[model samples]
Target: MRIIFSLFLVLSVSTIFSQEIETVQDSAIVKVDSLYREDQFYLGLTYNTLQQKPQGVSQNKFSVGLSAGFLRDMPINKDRTHAIATGLGFTFNNYVQNLAITGTGEMPFYTVLDDKTVFNKNKFTQLLVDLPIEFRWRTSTYESYKFWRIYGGVKFSYVLYNRSLYTDDQSKVVITNNIDFNKLLYGIYLSAGYNTVNVYAYYGLNPIFKSAEVGGENIKMKAFNVGIIFYVL
Candidate 1:
């Protein structure tokens, strides 16, 4: 009967091309399990508010610290949304204030009428060590889970040591021969995080102390900063 109607129309066109190749391999295994199924890491804790600017001093003081770091995820367009992160860290600080001396401010000369020496006072403390590198702009959906993230970076610091001394009454341990640690610092950071805890702010254009003249006139050191970060993952 015409060769069984041409073998039943070639087995119905080979069963519709084998059901369209198993529906394209089950939609590519659900798009590779939603693109890279999961594997990322992060652990963090940071706090910084150190300040110093002495080129023409107008009185300024602030210092507080603690930091730790490690974060990963850098994606540059691949239907992976977008991501970037790089952070390495260290911070330990303290800068308090209360100094007054102006009775013609005779360089370290105390006449008992005006001498409130407590500027740059240290009692075995003053440390700052930092290295922060960042760049992140992720709008979620790269897959593992994200609610928000926005970062900006640039942070480098050095002042790994400090000293303080004062022990009189026949014990003599006065080591306050002008405190100034030639450190090079730069800042401009911003951050926002959720699920791991992140919040930061820093603004220092470099000026912690390189100016002098207590009775001749000339001093500068003052800027601004803010902080709060905790992402122990």
Candidate 2:
């Protein structure tokens, strides 16, 4: 009976020691994961929509495109609850249309009077290269409640290529003639996302053109963008 009691005691001690070792291993793994996530890099894609309201024009217009870019998190605290990311990307848009023509200057290429070519209102495409920077704030941890993220940044884009107009149609015009293809672009971005879906908006602080005389004195590009982004290492 004394030998059996000794055996049971040894078994119980061994089980407790095994459980303690497992708990330590689990804790070490969690710490490693936290460190990795804090310093990781990511890339994503987004769909964007733009609007322009020229100072003298009465109509409000919009454009749509897809954007691709890379981002990195800049943690604001040791816990990595807040971060900032900045990167460069390109946006591709097609089936574009121009809405709201004002003044006596409506383009003949887009008007009903044009017999040679007409604006489909359903067919146009624009492509741009953009740079974006965002400041973000996040929740404390993966299991935390009341979770949210807010980002504000800017994007500079140049219309690298466009398929929305006709070369023969002199009526379709963008006023800025001296635009430095390398220098001129739009700016400012704000967004909110939960987990994998984010809604973003942008505003152009600079004119796409060098002068207002051509596209007009007050034409500007402003946009509201809504798209889904997945984090990939």
lDDT of each: 0.50, 0.52
Best by lDDT: 2
The regions of model 2 sitting more than 4 angstroms off are 1-63, 98-124, 142-146, 165-183, 209-233
Best by TM-score: 2
Model 1, 168-227: lDDT tens digits are 244423333233434666677786766456676767676554444344543344335566
Candidate 1, residue 117: how far the Cα is off, in Å: 35
lDDT of 2 by residue, 1-233 (tens): 99999999999999999999999998888433463332123334444454564433222244455667667666777777877676667777543333322222222222222333354333335577766777777664744433466777777776776443423333443322123222446678776666555566555576443333324244444444555544434
lDDT of 2: 0.52
Count of backbone clashes, every candidate in sequence: 11, 5
